[model samples]
Target: MTSMIQELTVSHNPFDMTPTMNYSNTTDSSFTNNSSTITNNQSYDGVDDFLLPWWQQTVFFLALIAILIIASGGNLIVIWIVLAHKRMRTVTNYFLVNLAIADFLISVLNMPFTFLFLLYQNWWFGTFFCKFSCFISPCTISVSVLTFMAIAIDRYMAILYPLRPRIPRRHVIAAIAVIWIISIALSLPNLIFFTTVEQSGVTLCTYTWSLDKDLAYNYLLLILNYIFPLLTLTITYSRVGIELWGSQAIGEETSVQHDRVKSKRKVVKMMIVVVIIFAVCWLPMHLYFLLSNHHPAVTKLDYIQQIYIVFFLMAMSNSMYNPIIYCWMNSRFREGFIRVFCWCPCRPCKKFRSKLRFRRTLFPTSVNAMSEKYSERNGSLMHTMTEYVDPDVNGPRRVSNNRNIVRKSDDYL
Candidate 1:
């Protein structure tokens, strides 16, 4: 039974938890019948013997610790900026908040366990966490990818139809909700399949599936989480780039229009870089899994374990990089980070408050200026319409009323 279980419980290479091994053909009936004893003996042989040297392990541990700190801290700042500031709550920023939430969860919940697993090469956190961490690893990644896709689509609509009404806040909320729902649904299979098994006395957490089922799941993850999102982002951003740079003026160019276009282009460029970075980071990990599963010989290479660690860490580092990118590309986010982090004296706060008051004071004057300009454009028509009216046509009172109405309109402006 133990031999059979070992043969049946091949690891699926999703999270890179399971070690690669070659099974030897055994015909001894005594070994087959008492396989449990052999397993126990192997377990007692010590799994820690495979661990890296002390200094190498320390370096790996420190790297993971740094990644955890940066990823969690950066993503928290992103969430805070979006939630605390009214100006930061635009549609794109809303999607960014969702992305940050996913990254935050991954940083806090997923990375530490993964670090331990990489260090120890065994499941030490027990069964519940074994299942949970496996499930959420894919879930958070799916959410991030879907959010990126949604942002790409949003940008496409905004650039392609500049005059169209903006997506309502409710709809944006609904879309975010849907992205999580889909992500959870996609991750349900992992929860069902992941289990802890003791082999050769060493406890391992891995997904146990029939060969066909494993292949199907891998292909599904590759398509849904990776390939499809990458293609959609690439196509959508390409169209957005063409639309942004292809046409000059559908009508007369104003300073406002030029500035708006420039701002949109800047934002689009930043998001494009974001999408590209995500793709580049995760692509190697996905390819590594694909190659390892299809051509098992690749896993036998001298540095395969080290290479796997590098690729896996690269993928995990995706969550850490986005906040840095945002601070680099967006001035508002930079200012928000500075305000949140910097300890400023009273003078700067006073200056900021005075600037706000000045803008408030100018608001009504700006509205009046717009109204007067609009009224001036139609002044000739208004005069023509009122010119032919006689004082006695209706009554002298009616002519007086018309003049009063005109006076009031001018006064309101």
Candidate 2:
């Protein structure tokens, strides 16, 4: 949001004039009241481009709404998948929960106000939210990228030093706290700069910082929020991938070793795909902000508002795609999503089994028969959900299902 946006307001209501284009592509940039000149009974050329052609508003309105639903909904499901299920909880997945929380917060707080502000060319949400949204958006963004770094590093450590102990739950919680603290500290400038401005009758919410400060901060965000984290993820994941994949041949490895390697590979692949999506989705917006801040006059070109709309959409849409990625790339997450949204049960649904067991328990004469039934049904449902610590080491816990399928530390991927 270090980008600056100022709209030139004219004092005229000429009949047959179309709605004015009051938007600037300066991120954290919107139709703002920063311009000094005001003309009476005069009109500006191409100033009415933002809100004209009613169909553009209709389409974009719907698109933003869709993004709101999917990003928030999918992230909520992802949170549930990790927290509500025992098997999904792991050292890396704790970071994922933080990531999902940050993304979900963006979907709720940023999307609606952004759309309304863009559509009306005014700050309709008021002063408190104006600053809060600006503050929270960058804060959450910082949290997500940092959490990505955490996940990558955790996976790297778990795979590279399989015998070493992993981070405990308490330490991971402390790390999440530290991530938030750092994010808020970085975002203080946004809170300071963001305010509601009054011009003519229009109200705008934006930062009014000096040009040098804005550019410095934008560049800082570029490095910290986008570039630095992108590099960190790439390097870490590349190394992790090498460690997981560069191993013994099929004929030489035992079944247990093979299964562990395969699980780690699947989880690593999913994370790599997620990081790539974040990079690709945010590139255009980052470039636009960089260019606009560097060359202020570029904001005044014909059709520039439309271009910003496209770039911003691409960036904001980043939140919505992650849930789909989780479902598509990982079977466990897919099962969780299905179990939640579709009301379909995971394989070996226990609802019927529990009912049958209760019925058998009601008849004392069938005690031996109940034991036989339980044996035939395999391990009890409790065993399916239980996670046991490996006697060999203190890394991630080993999980057993009804069929006694054992997964190493990386299965939470």
Question: Which of the numbered candidates is closest to the native, going by highest TM-score?
Answer: 1
Kindly report which residue pairs in candidate 1 clash with one another: 43-200, 43-201
Quote the positional error of residue 267 for candidate 1 in Å.
1.1
Q: What is the overall TM-score of model 2 with all chains considered together?
A: 0.75
TM-score: model 1 vs. ground truth: 0.77
All models: lDDT? 0.63, 0.64
lDDT per residue as tens, model 2, 1-413: 36344445320111001112233433433333322112213233333434647888788878888988899999999999888866567777788889989999877887677656655666777888888877777788899899889888888877776556778889999999999999999988877767777764667775677746655676787788888999888889888877776654433443334455566677778788888898898887666555554455555566654565666667778899889988897766776776665444544443322110102112223434323321101122222133332222212233323233445454345
253 Cα displacement, candidate 2 (Å) = 1.1
RMSD of 2: 10.6
What's the C-alpha lDDT at position 230 in model 2? 91
Clashes of 2: 5
TM-score of each: 0.77, 0.75
Candidate 1: list runs displaced more than 4 Å: 1-45, 343-413
